[model samples]
Target: MGAMNTKVIEAEYDYVKPASLDEALDILAEKENVKIYAGGTDLLVKLKMGADLGMDIMMDINGIEDLYGVDKTADGGLRIGAAEKIWNLETNADVIAMYPILSEAMHLMASVSVRNMATIGGNFCNASPVADTVGPCMCYGACVELKSKKGVRTVDATEFFLKPGVTVMEADEILTAIILPAPEENTGAAFTKMARVRPDIAKVSISCVIKRDGDAIKDCRMAMGSVAPKPLFLGDISAELAGKKMSAALIEETAQKVHDFVKPIGDHGTTAEYRKEMAHLIAKEILEKAWENSGGELA
Candidate 1:
């Protein structure tokens, strides 16, 4: 519910804007209840709602030079600095050209103004069930790089979020970058979102990346959001469909399976039943689109 109808933050915390990643990590290692602040889109709202975060330090990593770059990785994959704003990704020529699915997802995000302030890392770290970008990230076979003074480790994007308002990242670990594997040749991807309003929080969303093998499905990654505590990566569904020939019957059957697998709650701007059904419908739509985009006609 609404904590109060106020615009002021009720919590007490020290704000730290570090100029480098090492400086940021050092602050985190020494502090407790260190909330990594970015964009301040969601965090500020919660604080204004009078949520007691028990905050000790608000570490702003935007000033950190190492946490702000977009470059191609060694394997031709893309490495996106965690602090990149969502709006920038939407307009990045390389990102738009190479991963149109992500571009589409970005466009469907909040209004242009909010997107300007929201960082990509902040969105994932926020760990909202209705987060629009998480499913697309998982579908692209992405990983999140986490760094602490102890060392650095990578967590698969699909595995990062443990629950709402929680991630596998420790209090001291910082999300350094998002590593996205290069899309295989002849592969196509698709994304769809359902919300009460355009550019609003998603009620239900799905994304898929498909590598086509002639008329058969060579491989695929599928995921959905707003239907679970964390984004649901359909590894089982993808495994089951891999190597299977594409057909209307197969798509219809998979949709039924999706509806059965999802466990959405009846809240967040829609009914559980509605989200469940939309998940099924979206799966079918994206399956066909991705297949067609990969230069094959769905039979």
Candidate 2:
């Protein structure tokens, strides 16, 4: 009689820490099976939980010098180096004042210690069902710049997610940076989340950006998290309010539309109906707060 092998794979085959993006891409292209490690917050935890035991190699990109800073683009947009930690983005005054929605979303992420070690790139790459940054970034019209040995390509954050824990990133591609367009003049954004407690993953979250022209709503963008396979945009609802004067009735109508747009599934943390209702309430509240912050106009 012959016995079958029962040993389980417990760790990675090889590890490499590359000092440059080009070097990393070369390794990724040559390696048969490799995973990129960024902040290591999400990846490490998943590894420890036996999530990636089949991964044969790990390529650590944390040492790449070019991917660790925050800079402004020539077009007045903000370019966030992929390796920039969430804590830095949350506390940096320039980011806070310019992209308040991003700052707010970062602050609402995991605990302070996790935020210090978590990179924005890692957050997007992890592709969690309810990733906090995805909704806000999508609403703000952010794009991710991915680099590979072949070349570089940009993908809008809204289209980045294909499904839960899935993105458009190719095997040899690495996300290099996130680019956020500057908010329009007379524009403001607000993010609202409902969780069981502080530091808890959001049960549902909503982000809204509104631009005002005099006393009328000029444009609006709205997004929601934890309500679908990925974060969702309420463009239909936003379009309906364009050029309309902001009022309590208008806000409530928009909120109801948002409520109808989400198709949340029941999960451990919340019921689908609860999430739908909360999303409506939060969307309305955020719109009101953003309107007030924009000086009762549409800033």
Candidate 3:
């Protein structure tokens, strides 16, 4: 499917570049069989494969200045605009310092060239189960802002994706921004992935965020990707680990919980059983790294 498809993208669709969110929403509200064009990294590939053959209206919202940058919310969280490039997130000093897990995920995603052309919002809207950003975003307590002709609503990352290549987004909705809560003073986060290769889809990936109070885990959150239908958040497992002293035994128990909780599908890169196993391993590893970063020692 790579280069064999010779379809030209512009041949079938009427294009519109809306300069304002109001104009875009008006178009979306009025149009049927329309597709929102962001970075087009995944959209273009899907188009070439004829996945969206019936799509006749291509609404290019990239020109909307309101959806274009990362800013700080008054509540000490990050508001990442929908059209901000992946390359920007990877190299942005504020993003790197405050949200290193997001930076790590971005670094491990597609290639540098693809990242240059991909947007954070496009990645989420593409809704691939193995989307590298979703895992870390979930762990970081992120939410997405969706807008339509009606109004704007915020949805947590955990509740955003309905299934593979699907989301809670309505046909007329556009994801305007992603909001990430600032990490607490004692919190630390880490992300790890077991992919077939650097630039390929992850076989299994996990992100962990933990807050420590002296020697105990004060709070914890974990999210895993590519091992299930969508990125799975292990809130139960996180709760079990919280308030407990960090140790190899506790880590193993939590890892086992993760292994028991997920039901992964088998694919070329790994078997279902192997995916579950790696989920355990990577969960433990990332949790430990997060603990250590929060000033715990591996004893």
Candidate 4:
């Protein structure tokens, strides 16, 4: 077990820094109980809190050349390096212009210093239910690429999370990048969260994306955080509004459905009942805002 009751890491562990993607995969394949270190905003906190990671080696992925920078794909999509700093993504030009909701969420994710040291991959892999980026990423139809010595595979963001602090990644697999598809024309997204302060973990969070087709909802994706084991993707609920005309009555009815749908237990300094209520309100708030962005007015 790691040393407990301290605000600093005292455990003895060998740290390895790989130069390239292949080199990192080789180490991951060959090593036992190896943990990937990127940015270390979350991992370092765990170590300081004496959370037993049960690892023998810590692999620092920051040095890998392939795991840096964001690039636009040929199809007007984007490929975000897993180790790209949160600060960069929060302010990236393409992100701001193309995926505005994601950029907006990252801006409020944490304080400037922590964002400077936090990696997007590390943030997703940390698997916090209320992670600001994950909800927005999923809302935008993102996918995460998992690479390993054996090969690579892609998992849709909508299908990624299994539970709190857990993903479907294998032991030898490393999340190399996050890919986002081009948004359909007339599409818009909105994000909001409720926290105790300006810079605090969320008590409840919600994100919504809507593709408008002449004032009717052509398609929609909605997600709520801190109200379930993972960020709850309201696919079925979203489907209920697809191809339907926008109206205040419809939004209000769907909000009530959402209030009954989510199962929040309230572990983050709040009560279950409070989270449930806030989840409902936040859902309604984001949904209404997203509808407005999609060129609709409640009437």
Tens digits of per-residue lDDT, candidate 4, 1-299, equal 44376655876799898888999999989989999999988888888887779878999998788887799989989999999999999899999888899998899887999999999999889888888898889888899999998899999997889998999999899999999988778887899988889789888888999998886899989988888898778889998999998878888888889899998885748999998888778778888899888777777
TM-score quality measure for candidate 2: 0.93
Tens-place lDDT per residue, model 3, 11-71, is 4789899989999999999989888888899888878766644788888878799898888
lDDT of 2 at 162: 82
What residue runs in model 4 are displaced by over 4 Å at the alpha carbon?
Answer: 1-4
Which tens-of-lDDT digit does each residue in 1-299 have in candidate 2?
12322253356468889878889989988876788777788877766656644678888888698788888888888999998999999998878888898899999898999998899999898888688887778877899999989999999998888888889999888899999997778887899889989788999998888888878888888888888987777778888888999998889888888888788999886899999889889988999987776666433
TM-score of each: 0.97, 0.93, 0.95, 0.97
Pitting candidate 2 against candidate 4, the one with the higher lDDT is 4
Cα error, candidate 3, residue 83 (Å): 0.7
Better of 1 and 2 by TM-score: 1
Q: Would you list the C-alpha lDDT of every candidate in the order shown?
A: 0.87, 0.84, 0.88, 0.88
Candidate 1: Cα lDDT at 100: 84
Q: List the residue pairs that clash in candidate 4.
A: none
Q: How close is candidate 1 to the true structure, as a TM-score?
A: 0.97
Candidate 1: segments with Cα more than 4 A from true spot: 1-3
- TM-score (C-alpha, index-matched) for candidate 4: 0.97
